[model samples]
Target: MSDILFSLPVEQQITPCLTLCKKDELPVIVINHPKAKGAISLQGAHVLSWQPEGEKPVLWLSPESNFKQGVAIRGGIPICWPWFGKAGDPMHGFARNQLWQLIAHDENDECVWLTFSLEDNEQTRILWPHSFSLIARIKMGETCEIELESHGDYSFTSALHTYLNIGDIDQISVSGLGPNYLDKVVGGEHTTADKKLTFSGLIDRIYTQPESFSVIADPANQRSIEIHHKNASDAVAWNPGAEVAKGMADMPDDGYKTMVCVETAYVTNARTVTNDKPQFLSATIRCHKNEQK
Candidate 1:
């Protein structure tokens, strides 16, 4: 890998080619390099875009997503931590609403390594009283690798809420999920999927004891995506479908047709972590434009 340099925004002044910018007033770090390109918002340390060389976007972003402060964008790899879903106030927790610090970054011809950290504050303590540190380390290249670590004493459900884009939801199938899942669409009814998951209705299921790698086949786009993860036993597959997409103020009526959520998570009675034990999760996503089989 060749050594590369990028210029950062005058205010951020981090490095070369890695610039700091704003989108509709939200602070973001824009990475424009030879091997990778993407944008990461400091607010939540959330990845908004990651389009590697010679491939389509692996992440799905809602077109109508609001980039305002305190407003979580409707897509991308949302770090659903401390608690998942509506278990706590402010919807998916305040982590997405708060800003994080860029702790480290290194670049080469192959990829760029970035680490961001978010620690407990008065505001977070007010919501869920606990002192903790959340670190998100991302490596961008042909394959986007993300690792999340929680350093504290706590037991909470979490997920790397990832949204995968598809040419057509009806023509896609997610393989490698657990055989059994708790169907959220049918009020947490336990069920089993016969084969690869195909979207037809409002599908929201938490697949427990899942495999390490899942394949998302997008026949309409003539490509498939590989989602591999570690340090987790669960996966969440969500598609709002037609009927339920009607009431979402953040999502358009037809938005669900373009994207699906296949998150690597730990939602089912996540193991407790104390000062003696630190919790962590890692995942890597690779996109390939192979002809659909």
Candidate 2:
């Protein structure tokens, strides 16, 4: 872990709330606001952690995550753009593996907002031949909000792959994803979702036209997490289980027991972005006491 501090254009505005530091040689922005605390890495513009005051962490991050360049950090929220998953060689697009510029930032009594931007370069064009500008705006406060916008003249599949923290995988239930989905673990077999989804083993399904919001009820933690999304045509639910997680070097074998991914996405159906009509995908997360339990 490197301890070198870097200077930002908005260094003065960042005082009393944010700091620019290096972690494992990658530039990171550490947030310490009155309402919340979090960290965002410039590499991929990935959000590594977030916790509202007086509450448990809302996101999950792998302890063994690599903080080096050109590698995807295993946790928090990863921005997958242009192409998602095996649509390209890098698995989940180049957006999350590239360094993004912090174009702007602001602070208010209730929230702190940071805007990061990435555009096509020779390296990115080599991976996917297209001209584009991507902007990720993050707001941290009592509630966490992330919005991704694309300006280009091309169609693409993307997702905000969010890994949520939970008390225990077995003690939680996720609801609001409608009845149908494509089961990826079964090689894309279509399946139906139960009223409330529970985890027992490897589960990977994509709900093409899910409801706009999903709630994770965690009785053991005495809280429920609500994920409200906008302009997303699909919702992805995933958990690798013990056997599959064992093969991953970044995540512990039992990591799946405490986390779940309910991603907001534009998969299965790609969205076309143009200069005249930019595309936007956003998700807002809030945690509340589990009143039912």
Candidate 3:
């Protein structure tokens, strides 16, 4: 740990507020700004945790998650890029599995911004043969925002797979997504939500052309989480439920009871990027007191 911290480039260290540290065997950026506290692992440029000064944690990280190289960290915001799901090899592309370079960072009275970059290399070429550059810019403060930008001549599907921490899955409801969705659990069958969504069992549905924002009302926690997105045509709502969670080695059997995924994505309609035109997908998250009922 001492060696890793000492070896960090001077430009990358912000001191007292932001610094490079080792978590297990992976390099992690620890944030201790006055307004919030958080951590980001370079392995995936993955935001592991974030908590505003007076609020509970907004992101969820699995207790059983592995903190090693080449393995997804189970929770938080995982970058599913280039292609989503089984559209390509290794599942969800290579962005989350590859180490990212921290190219820039800055802090201000309102927020701290960090930019991480990942470009196609020999390892990434073996997975998907393409010449490209990916940039992830994250802002942490009273609100958490992440923007993913792609520079290349290609069309691809991607997602900011954000896992949110809830007091209880059964006590919460999600709104703003329109009535139509594709249920992946039922083999991508088209379905309609018809109303605000409440979880009961395994729920994995892709809401197409939904509203720009979605809100999770959590009465149990006396708070609500709102996710606002841009440049995304789709949104995914997921909860593995009890049975599936039991089988996941990285998640506790009851993990589904406290976490829900409301992802910002471009799945059904892949975004195209050219040398002259770069594509972007972004999401901003805010947590506040729920309405009194």
lDDT of every model, 2 decimals: 0.83, 0.88, 0.88
Work out the TM-score per prediction: 0.93, 0.94, 0.94
How would you encode candidate 3's per-residue C-alpha lDDT over 129-241 as one tens digit per residue? 88999999999999999999999998899999999999999999999877778888887657564668999999998998678899999888899999997999999999999
> How many pairs of residues collide in model 3?
0
lDDT of 2 by residue, 1-293 (tens): 11122232333336679888777768889888889988899998898888898888889888878889999999899999888888897988999999999999999899999999999999999998999999999999999999999998999999999999898999999998878888888776465646888898999888876888999998888999999979999999999999999999999989999899999998988899878999999999999986662
What are the per-residue Cα lDDT tens digits for candidate 1 across 60-164? 777677888888888888888888888888777788888999999999889889999999999899999989998999888888888988888878888889888
Candidate 1 Cα errors over 4 Å, as ranges: 1-13, 291-293
Error of 3 at 74 (Å): 0.7
**What are the RMSDs of all candidates, in order?**
3.9, 3.3, 3.6
- Measured with C-alpha atoms, the lDDT of residue 228 in candidate 3 is 97
Window of ten residues with lowest summed lDDT in model 2: 1-10
TM-score of 1: 0.93
For model 3, the local distance difference test gives 0.88
